[model samples]
Target: MSSNSPSSPLRVLVVIASSRPGRLAPAVAEWFVETTRRETERERMVVDVVDLGALALPFLDELEHPSTGVYAHEHTRAWSRRVADADAFVVVTPEYNYGMPAVLKNALDYLYEEWAWKPVAFVSYGNTSAGTRSVQMTKQVVTTLRMMPIGATVALRIGDSIEDGRVSERPMLGRAARQVVVELARVARALRPLHLAPATDGTTPGPVDGLSLSRVGEGDDVSELLVLQRSCWVEEAHANDTLDLAPLHETLADVQAWAKTWTVWAVRRHGRLVGAVRARAVGSTWEIGRLMVAPDQAGNGIGSWLLAVAEQHAPEEATTVALFTGKRSRRNIALYERAGFHLTAAPTTPDDAVLLTKSVAATTLA
Candidate 1:
């Protein structure tokens, strides 16, 4: 996991798939990126342009299967990392003999797991067929990698859509390009959980049975966390006998702001965001907050499991771990008590809230 702030943008990589000396792939890619710049920024996406002509990957030379992940050359490793880091991909390609360029296929063949469970959009250009056949051939290969090929695409006929070696400026063409990116973003986000949490083969220890836990990363969306916090805090309002609560009232912007300073962990079960917790070392004490589990997922020991996971992330210098809850929220207090926390007096806490603390040997946690 990359451990990026929850509000970080989706990483959309634009790939120019022609390596010939005088090729129009780069121009087409640039036009698409510029055409969709406004929507990309509005949707909180980050675009990175990758020109395969500059990458210079040779024909497949590794002896091992790509799934084994053992690359014999530095070029393969570099390409692997680039593709792995992307949340979604847009391949700008030109038809070659009515099929995708061999270089594009070679690039796709360089890695296995890195490409799975992500969305791919295509902007294809060529003659009469407008490169639709190339897209069809590429779709067959991409599906084998578990990459979803979206229905929305940009198809440009070289003669009709290009002018002076550049894609012509036209409102309808720009709109089509923007629509492809918009739909790609939608599918990218929708399929993010699958990309984040792959099916484990039961060899490694996890937070709980059937639950996958990992550090939150840059491309992870915080909208789900905001909704989970509000849903979980409603119970606290009833128990505490007051409507004034930070979690209950914190806007999405507020949550995003706090996420920057906190090292957060997200928990999932079967591809659903089920729980999350954030912790940061405050002086010698580790402060843990925003611990939550979906309402329907409560009472399955997820809260306790998540607390243990959060504590494991505490800093070495921290001798104490602390958290706060509504003063009258007995259920929360009881849960904390079972995890070795004790109610403590704090002058800085609001009258309606109570702080809890637990001492742990710094050496052990370190």
Candidate 2:
């Protein structure tokens, strides 16, 4: 798991949930394999794909609870093993009414811990929204299972890209696919250590002392909160090997305003301001905007402590908690994944950051 060591090949499970023959999964899967082979070969990483459509998985409804570790059905157990064995996953799905198909959701629900601590990406296709809604919904569910969904999603808009039952390759689509592959590689590399870490017993730890979670409001810690902002951006720069601090300072006011409306944790270590995290409430969902720890205190587990406090505070109101990180912040991204945030299908535009989220009530802490 050392960053410098020659890591094992990445076992990728490509789930094609759509049953329709002319659906976009074939083209999307092909694109993923082609692009992934090229990029992984350059990195000396092996890659493999599993087509779920060919697995013939049945709709979920059975005699046993997945969380209890008893899978009664044969197909369910097989699917669980497939999921458990893989190093990462890529879900090729077709959008249906601003959400993913029922079959896909059912497949995911069939297994709990088998999917934990792994990385996932999406290849989505649909009309107007281009499966953005489906991606959003899927992200919430995956996070509940403690999976790391890396930024780098491929979304294909219908009509403009389909021809005679085949999805014609657009140059732009290929480029996006390549980007997703590259990002997935980075995420897999980052999570390898955690994947190899010792498993935790099923017990949630108590919240840290002096760090309480409350709804963000007036008179809360502001300057103390600024430290998190600085820490996240500084760490982001260091991870990327860049030194631009302008964006870190420029977004202060905006982030502060965001804190006022959402739940923000004031992380006090030994009764002194050290770090903080601010999550904004958007509709029924909450997005974590600023999660930072003082640079000098990062490895001391302050960030992880703050994140646990925030998750405990998030569940009663919001359906999910989402956040974005810089593509280059390898450590931060892995930390977020370990905390149960999953990546969704959102293009990482120069200004549009990488998005990650977890379902509030659906996820458990251990």
The top-ranked prediction according to TM-score is: 1
For candidate 1, report its TM-score: 0.58
| Model 2 deviation from native, Cα RMSD in Å | 19.6
Candidate 2 TM-score, true structure as reference = 0.51
Tens digit of per-residue lDDT, candidate 2, span 1-366: 111122556666677767666567777777667756677677555555656666667777666566533455557656655665566788888888888988788888887756766689998888898887898999999999878888888887777776775667678887887787778777876665444321221222212334333334555676556655666676577766666644466555765566667766654555566666766567877666566777766554456555655555554678887777776665566566645566677664345356777887534322
List RMSD in Å for every model shown. 17.0, 19.6
Model 1, range 1-366, lDDT digits (tens) per residue? 111222357788899999988899989998899899999998888898999989989999988687655566768767776776688999999989979999999999987766877899999999999989999999999999889999899999999999998899988899898898789989987766544322222222342456877776544757888888899989888988888888989887887888888888878788788888998988999999988999888755567557766776667778899999887776677567545577899899988889999885521321
In candidate 1, position 309 carries an lDDT of: 65
TM-score of each candidate?
Answer: 0.58, 0.51
Q: Which pairs clash in the backbone of model 2?
A: 149-343
lDDT score, candidate 1, position 350: 87
